[model samples]
Target: MSEKNRQGKRTARERLAEEREKQKSAEKRRRVLIVGASVVCVLGLAAVIGVVAANVGKDDGSESAGPVVVPSGAKGKDSLAIPVGKESAKSTLTVWEDFRCPACKAFETAYRPVIHELTNSGQLKVDYHLATIIDGNMGGTGSRTAANAAACAQDAGKFTAYHDVLFDNQPEETDDAFAENSKVIELAAKVDGLDTPAFRTCVEKGTHNSWVDKSAAAFRNGGFTGTPTVILDGKNIYQDQTMTPAKLKQLVQEAAKG
Candidate 1:
């Protein structure tokens, strides 16, 4: 073949190879773009699902469907509170907590002694409000079931004992172990006279589920946003950044003085 023809053929072959390489690179770029968009869309959908699941039991001004069985000493607008101090006490400390909340467990473990001292000394009256926001966020019946069992303990006149045990034995945040009625009853056995057949029946049948629902509703409607929400003399101490367990005592004493 002529040298000119040979050179032209070689150049054409090289050009063809370059064209194929460019096409492959363009196809690879298109695939990458498609994969990235798909990933973003999937993440967006997952985020939406998470938000919806977290708000499943949120209070929307709607009442509970079941009958709300308020405990004997329950107080509050919807009768969903358990009071733990003398009526004549000057300081009112309101606590909103969820049994499944790790933060609530931390607060309870850290401040239980001071809380007991104040309540025992009649220097403070604490109103305990149970919330099940964990159940809403984590997708389990454990929060509701545990709250109902606590109410049942109140019926048996053992709220404080059972309440202490519940926090002491709080499972991992995502663990739905508390959802089992048998497990709740077993925990009740830790509190004297709290494991009675009546209490068992109350928990097994979820007699106070409505009250738990109402408590959650009251929590949301009370303009609170999270667990371990501590309020003293109508002031939200949890909102204060410098407030510690010691500061809590001072705040309560000051409130009592007023």
Candidate 2:
């Protein structure tokens, strides 16, 4: 090969290597920039989450620290249960529920008719213990707030109707609509004579917040796993996959016969 051609070839190889090195450097810089941006975004999201968590914690602390005020006609230990039937009924259903819990709403929707029938017929009584587990799990005060409002309804002698209203109008699990007292009071309008000034004051003041908190503590301490912990005559009937509203009515009827 000619010397000039050889020299030209060597120079060309050097230029090619330099070009490849520049491309690699550019790619490395680009990757670093992308990683840095991703980290920044992650940190920003974490900060926002932290703020939200802190705010929720503060709200929970303030609301749950009040004096325990039991609603009128509340029964059971420490007045934690809101009874929804005649005390003389043969079958008693003990229900632990959270208003914001979708499963609890589902249970209420499915069994409401049967329960109302049994209660009205004086064949069965239900002791509803409200819990705020959804608030603890989902990071909001909707569960606690709604439970307080229900307690206020109990004070107004309209618990069952107001309770049904709450379940009927339950928002999405993640939606904290019930955390606002106004929203809760708005729902009370659906129940006859439940939107009085006394009820509104009780709800707005969170009069039963401490009671609801205590009930939630009881639920947690009772070794229960989830909401809608339905117990019929000391049996956790809710765990029975074969259980249905008709089956529940049958069981209650059998208990009444016994």
Candidate 3:
């Protein structure tokens, strides 16, 4: 078998143990696992390139379906409800990611328009599943820190806002940590009526940590070992450099038609 297939044969526990040897914490290991998984990943679907939307929370005025329901207690967004399309949308595209990852940053930037096109036009719905499985020390805290800030952002219903800011000002994980660093507090400050104090305190104490950490654990359990891992209507979309906006849109549209 090929190297990818060779690696794929290992169970999550086996891969996780190996990843832990490389990273450390189960959280970080999980992030590493995801990155590893995304490289080859449980494969399926087409590849596209482009920008997508990043909104927060639920909207009452919009027609079609309701809000995206998060199983582990839905969180908040910085600005508006995460810019989702139809709540009851037949086609749901969910992303399991770590904010600190560089690849995820690229994917988010590329996915913006695609998500907008699909959701805004009411053809699809998307929800973000935070996994701070990786640490900043690797490529940056794009994994953990971003996930934490996202949780705080979600608390204030500013997840999408914080998400954009996090990507816009992504710092070097090795040089500066965003996950447990002061930047998270600063980001929390930017959101109006966001209970910054509570968010800061919560993050510091890890009050809402379970959501991010547990999700990372779930990612591990779900057979997804990576950041920016996209699940399209229960199907895994595995693409490395090829996972562009056009590709995501194509899969979503094709899935919708099916």
Highest-TM-score candidate:
2
The TM-score between candidate 3 and the true structure equals 0.58
Full candidate order by TM-score, most accurate first: 2, 1, 3
Candidates 2 and 3 compared by lDDT, better number: 2
How would you encode candidate 2's per-residue C-alpha lDDT over 1-258 as one tens digit per residue? Answer: 999999999999999999999999999999999987654442223343233234232223434666788899998988888999999999999998888877677677778999999999999999999987767767789989999999998888899999999999999888999999999999988888888999889988888988988887787678775767789989988767667788899999998888
Q: For each candidate, what TM-score against the reference?
A: 0.74, 0.76, 0.58
Residue-wise C-alpha lDDT for candidate 3, range 110-134, written one tens digit per residue: 5666777888777798777765544
Global CA lDDT computed for model 1: 0.80
Range of the 10 consecutive residues with the lowest summed lDDT in candidate 3:
51-60
The CA lDDT of each predicted structure is 0.80, 0.82, 0.57
lDDT of 3: 0.57
Residue 110, candidate 1: how far off, in angstroms? 1.1
Candidate 1, poorest ten consecutive residues by summed lDDT? 40-49
**RMSD, model 2, all Cα superposed?**
13.7
